[model samples]
Target: MELRDLDLNLLLVLAELVREKSVSKAAENLGMSQPGMSNALNRLRALLGDDLLLRTGRGMQPTPYAERLAEPLNEALRLIHGVVNLEMDFDPARSNRSFTIAMTDIGEIDFLANLMRALERVAPDVSISTVRKGESNLKDELETGAVDLAIGWLPDLNAGMFQRRLTASQYVCAFRKGHALDKGSITLEEFARADHLVVLAPHTGHMMIEHDLGRLGVRRNVKLRIPHFAAVGHILSETDMIAALPGRLVNHSIVPFNLAWAPLPIKLDPIPLNVFWSAKYHRDPANQWLRAMMFDTFSEGAPHVSPDQAVPLP
Candidate 1:
């Protein structure tokens, strides 16, 4: 028979009948009456010029033609399914879109200033909402589109994740000027003795440093635990409590507040921060544009650079 004489739905019935080996069971699987299945089977057999299945004492057995048709027919059905389900490609220059970003304190430390400057120069009307996505929740949050993009240190875990590098972040010490330790390089004893403002959110890992120090038998006195990095900076400017912050924020503090960043008394390894969006948003146009901006914002140095180091916008 020509292709138009056969229906694809009959292929589904043929496949299921071959699998189930019983007319009644195939009908049950297809939600059709047994007589209805027999009638469709008769029509399919007439179209193919073959007794596709034979009633045997054991049950129904496929004829040679049916066996030969089964594999290619299933393959063709899968191909059609995949083609019909394909996602459309995205375009950014012509689309006006909003994006929600999940960023850690360090993401703000590393990228926010330049992001604002870049927005001023480019897509100022594109609204960006920054939300706190605790490190623990990043993977599921990204996959579900609870947040479109996340920027921070790549978690030590979740290698299955998808990411792009934003920048490297170095840790530094932040204390108000004229504090008791400002006379010279801070001694380890002075650092451990000073009261520290620690951030205890699951998103912040400052406790690890403290825990490592405790292992060394030289723990700093944690004077308080606050929720956000912005809060930590504000308190450091107004009080004697010192904070260990990312280099970008400390550098920003140099101009905006009378703050000094001496080397950390105990060396902390620099964290490599990245932009991670799930494969779910990998095809979304707005997510792509923001990711491009995130990389560009980092590659073009942060606003913390001296005027001579910055490229003047046209």
Candidate 2:
């Protein structure tokens, strides 16, 4: 269909319909009547010559055609919105902007509290929301403006994304404060002999430390596997199962559990913690401020371990 034939307003209806997935809900969001939303949907179907949405037991599901349009449509709308607002200057002190970030449970534990405290003093009107990072779709989410920033050990970001390294993190062995290993430096044999609790990231179903151990032909006696790092502290506090976690996550000042940590006995390269954003928002004033705030917060507060501290197994 020619651009001249299309109603730009219909694109807004389509975007809301795709997001809300229900005509009534989309209408409510757009402040239009249900009949009006249905009429808009009909117009969109005729324009595209495809069924955009279908009814399913779960709810309204996007058809293959609708799914194909979802990303580019959102990106286009975001760009248009950005262009329209390009002249407005961001005043952090007065603006009540909300930012959505994608990160792991570990990141929430290590970064959020401190960052919020800092923002409370400087950008009191701002709000924050967080979503879990999906391994496969993180790049798409950023590009589509679903999330403003992603923070973690995201090593495989897509080419067009911009990343700034926050710090290099190394694994540390953590257990209850009074655990035997806490009395002295842990040895490789002792570490391997202990029952362990491991984290398998929900999106990737991979455990970085386990993968590293496997490569070195060193395996731990893993007794439990969980999907969130937040559970590690509580589990380690009550059970004999220790965990290998990023050092920043076990810092006593931030974590509530009565835990003690030591450098891993086996050598592993430091993982680079990065803040990732799409080049699309690289120069956007609000986005730039948030990125700078994140960089400053993490770089100053999060723990870092130098490469010289990594100890090799015998």
Instruction: Please give, for residues 246-268, the per-residue lDDT of candidate 1 as tens digits.
Output: 67767766656788766666655
> Compared with the true structure, what per-residue lDDT tens digits does model 2 show for residues 95-114?
89999998877778778887
TM-score leader: 2
The CA-based lDDT of model 2 is what? 0.82
What residue pairs are clashing in model 2?
none
Residue ranges of candidate 2 with Cα displaced over 4 Å: 1-87, 202-206, 252-255, 299-309
The runs of at least 3 residues in candidate 1 whose Cα sits more than 4 Å from the true structure, single-residue gaps closed, are: 1-93, 154-157, 299-314
Per-residue error for 184 in candidate 2, Å, reads 2.8
- What is every candidate's alpha-carbon RMSD to the true fold? 11.8, 17.4
Assess the local accuracy of residue 238 in candidate 1 as a C-alpha lDDT between 0 and 100: 86
Candidate 2, position 128, lDDT: 95
lDDT, model 1, position 105: 69
TM-score of 2: 0.68
